[model samples]
Target: MMKYMKHLLVILVITIPVLYTVFLFGYHNQTQTTVIYHGINLFRGEEGGDQPLFEKREFTAPLSYVILLTLTFGIVIAAVAGLIWLLFSRWEQRRRLRSEKREERKERLYIEGIEYYFQGDLDMAEKIFEKVKARFPAFISPYIRIADIHYRRRDYRKSLELLDQARVNEAKRVDIFLRKAENFLALDDLGEASAALERAAEIDPKNLTVLEYQRDLYIMREKWEEALEVHKEYVRLVKHRRPEMEEIQNRLQYEIARKLVASEEGKGKAIRALREIIRSEPRFIPAYKVLGEIYVEQNRAEEALKMWEKAYKEHPEHPILLTWIEDVLYEQGAHEPRMSELYRKALEKSPHDRLLKLFYAHYLLRLDRVDEAEALLGELERTGGRLPLFSIFRSEIYERKGRFKDAIKALKAAYGIHSFNEMVFSSGNGLFEHPLHRQRTVSWYTWDRYRINTGQELIPMPDIQRVHRA
Candidate 1:
């Protein structure tokens, strides 16, 4: 019965304005009749019924009187209605203002709590926020803000507690799920975080924030397949919001493909996955490097070389690829002539690269070009570089060339920079019984910057060089 009364009241309230409009039009039409009635009645009373100013028809029936009575009644009803409407409108405005003031007070308190939080006054902040929650349990903002305070303080447990309370209060709010998930993530609770993200995604799959964080969770867990799917969804959202990330999209695809390869075991399938990465982002250098490494491990040196060469062509200044090329050639120990040519070509492109210069010098030395090796070493020394073993090699070359004094001088300089162990010889030209023991002793003394003293005394160069030549 009450519901029916309420419905009827609503209907009447809606129809009142329409009724008022009809009354206004009806009252306007009655005004002319009332004015004519006043003129006719006055003249009829002043002159006799047959006066020239007053026709019998004008005085007949006093029709304007009825019109005047009707107009008076219409004015009274309109005035009453307008007074009632004005009173009701004022009442309603006051009621709304009161409600707005109450909300404004609550919101101001909530804002004060947030300010306290920002000022690092956690006790005051928590107190004010708790008051808000108690006063307005129906409001989600208090719960959200209080939980955020806990999260900011790294109190994940307390944060979850507040969020749980929020759920108990309003179990259907989407914001609760998101905040809960964020708290779990801050706690490093990936399982809970993933579950929360999944729920949030289910509720509002268009939420790209949830999808992105969930995708990262999947990646951390090494759930590559799930990660790939979620990343695809994220890319779609990104395409809608940011159309300029086309290159980034390709790179994401490449990463997904690479992770797929790493997580799968079948060699054939992994290779195909790697190839997919290359197809998606052809300039992804890591894919090429990994492919080359795989090929090298499989003893397919030629294919490895091809991949490295391609990488070098794409990024010509990449030292790692150049190093790979030199390493591959050195391992194969073939085509010495081509190796030298390649080394020179790479050095010409990057003259200041010390590693390239070292490789080039070694390649020249391997070809028995001692003079070139010595000249290169000299250049490195002039640039204040330190090559510990190069001086020894130069000294050996000098000794082989019969430049004994230059060899000795080079040996002395090498000794000053590095430890030069002297050889011991017997006059009878017999070998030391324990060469290993003597070498170990010499190495230790040399490393300690001490000269090796045989207690027996020092030996001459003639016999030492003779033994060394032997």
Candidate 2:
């Protein structure tokens, strides 16, 4: 009803002005008197002189100009409105095309930058992204990409500054928080990392990536109990029972146990936790190692060896148990005979375990029993021990026995062009990677000062000195 009223009011407003102007222009003050027949012949001079020749009738009505004027005015208004609409439509179309082209250029540059990034050209990728960002500052992707370039360049502070400069809602963007957390972690700012992770988790509580980052943050902080909790949530959120996830959870449990062993009163709890972990995963090397160490700390060497022996029964020729055994008993001042008997027993149990045989040979060379190591290496060769490490070991044994020529021959065999980097090795830290270790091992903050008291004496720094194999 109001709509009709507004339209009617507009028509009246337009038509009223047109009707009034037409009335003024069409109206005139003129005499329009009718003549009487008795006085009509005064001005007659023709054959019809008696006729009232000039009698003028009074105006009955003025022509109706209101409708005509109103129509003309309406047509004029419509033509002007249509012209304005046509021009506006063209202008809007051109503007839209320009905007689309601008967006396309931005997209093209972004794709080009991404391609360079994938091709491992960080400098070119960064330059292209800088151009994109300068021209299209509102684009979030360019900012992220540029920050990533800084991160890859190890300019963590610059990456963080760019993230801070992003004109976006930080709390609402889980990815931003995640990247910020990564930068903070790179800088070893655990507190800032934790805060970013917490904010990310708040934004996306069930996100697996967020939980993983949270778990990592806690692990870096050495808050094993908290890390364990976060890991549990990650496990719960995961849809599949992946071996990797199970392995990670087991490591978290081990770390928690390790932490508990830090305090005098927490030893028993730590011990129980370690035992529980071992029971759940008998082959988990770190739990066995740590538990054995703890038992040795409590003057329980017999028990430590007994526990390892139990696990060795399940995986008879496993290198981790043997190596841990070697380390522990060496600290116990293991003699040539004692260590030999240990290997001999293991070799007898797994006669065909080539890796085991290689390990034994390596151990012999370490003991400077060159003849025994050579005999074992010869046996390995006879059995087609094709492992590249076999050649490395062969070279070591040959060098030990004053066969420099043969040592060089063996060394050459290990580093063919394609196989130069094939024999790389990294030790496991139990069921997971050792916490907070990369580019360094056992950082000072996590390293136990009194490791000697816990039956973990320092082996020499050159425990596995390189012969320049790689």
Candidate 3:
């Protein structure tokens, strides 16, 4: 009813002015009348005052002229109104077009900036992004790109500032919130990162990017349960089942179970969690490892051995599980025959596995079977792709056999092979062209220090002596 009344009001407002104009003109046309007057001519000096004045004449406009005048006035008013409306419409259209062009230009610049960013031209990319931000302050893309550049440069504070500016422009945007969370995480501000992610979750609870970041944050803070929940949600969001996702979730659950096993009250829960993981993902080796450790902690040595044996049967070439199995057997004083049998069977299945061979050879060496270990090491050496560890083992065997000179030669060979591959010195936390050189130098220095401590002859390397002189 109100709508109809408004429409009626609009119609009346427009018609009233036209109707009044027509009515007033029509009334004037009807009421108008012609009038005539006769008077004496005062300026006529010769004529008598009473002499009749010249006949007076008068004229009145025709009714047709009044009607023509009213029609012409209405037409002129209507034409002027139409012309004004047309001009205003054209102006509005031009304004819209200009706005669209401006938006297009901004989008183009943003795309170009992204391309430059991908091309690794950070300077050019930064300048273009800055230009875009300056010209289009409300545009969020450039703000984010610039923030990313700052982040790559490790300028967390500046990155956060740009992200804050973006948030101000678009408070509800999830990407902006995620970027802020990343910046906070980079700065080790876990609490602020969580808060930012929470805000993003409120905006879009099922956003995959938001959930992934939330999971990472939880993991960083060691909030295992929260991370598990987020990972589960992420798996559900994905349409297809992925093996990696299942593995990640199981690993997280395994970690949680491990943490639980640390407490007396939570042991039962931990065991149940571990069992559930094994049941769900039998091939997940870490679950078996953790479960075996839990069983061993509970003094259930037999159960732990059974778990490891089962894992070995399922994954025969798993080096870690094989090592655990050997350790368990040795602890139980039943290692000899069982250890030999396990290695033989595993080698039969995967004879080309060098790491497995190394493990076997090391085990043999531990058992004082030096000849057998040497035989395996010789076979590995003759195979033409010997590892440095092989030479190290050979040196160990040579030392055990009282062949000091041969041992040193083997050690030098190992060092030379290692120099080409090792780029970082583990001792000093530095990189070098030949890490083995640094290692040998450091070892000699350490041995000399020991000799000095013992009042023995110091065997300093040539390089070390030069350094000491310098």
lDDT for each candidate structure:
0.61, 0.69, 0.72
Model 2 lDDT tens row, 1-470: 35544755687688778776666666653323333233234556667656775564443344444344457788688757766776787799899999999989989999999999889899999999999889987787778887888988989999888887673634377788888887886777778988987888888999988887777666656677897888888888888877667666677787778777888899999888888877776766667878898888999987888777768878773555676666667678864576678778887878887767766776766677788878988887888845555666676667667777776666567555243234442222121121222224321223222222222332212211111110
lDDT (Cα, tens digit) per residue for candidate 1, span 92-188: 9899999999999999999899888878898899899999989988887777777877777889899888888888877766667777877776676
Q: Poorest 10 consecutive residues of model 1 by lDDT?
A: 461-470
Score residue 319 of candidate 3 by CA lDDT.
Answer: 54
Q: Compute each candidate's TM-score over C-alphas.
A: 0.56, 0.56, 0.67
Query: The CA-based lDDT of model 3 is what?
Result: 0.72
lDDT of 2: 0.69
lDDT of 3 at 240: 85
lDDT by residue for model 3 (187-214), tens: 7787998999899999999998788777
Q: Which stretches of candidate 3 lie over 4 Å from their true place?
A: 1-85, 384-470
Those runs of model 1 whose alpha carbons end farther than 4 Å from true positions after fitting are 1-69, 119-123, 168-175, 239-276, 279-283, 294-300, 326-347, 351-470
- Taking all chains together, the TM-score of candidate 2 against the true structure is 0.56
RMSD of 3: 16.2
Order of candidate numbers by lDDT, starting with the best: 3, 2, 1
Better of 1 and 3 by TM-score: 3
Q: Please name the candidate that would achieve the greatest TM-score relative to the true structure.
A: 3
How many clashing residue pairs, candidate 2?
Answer: 0
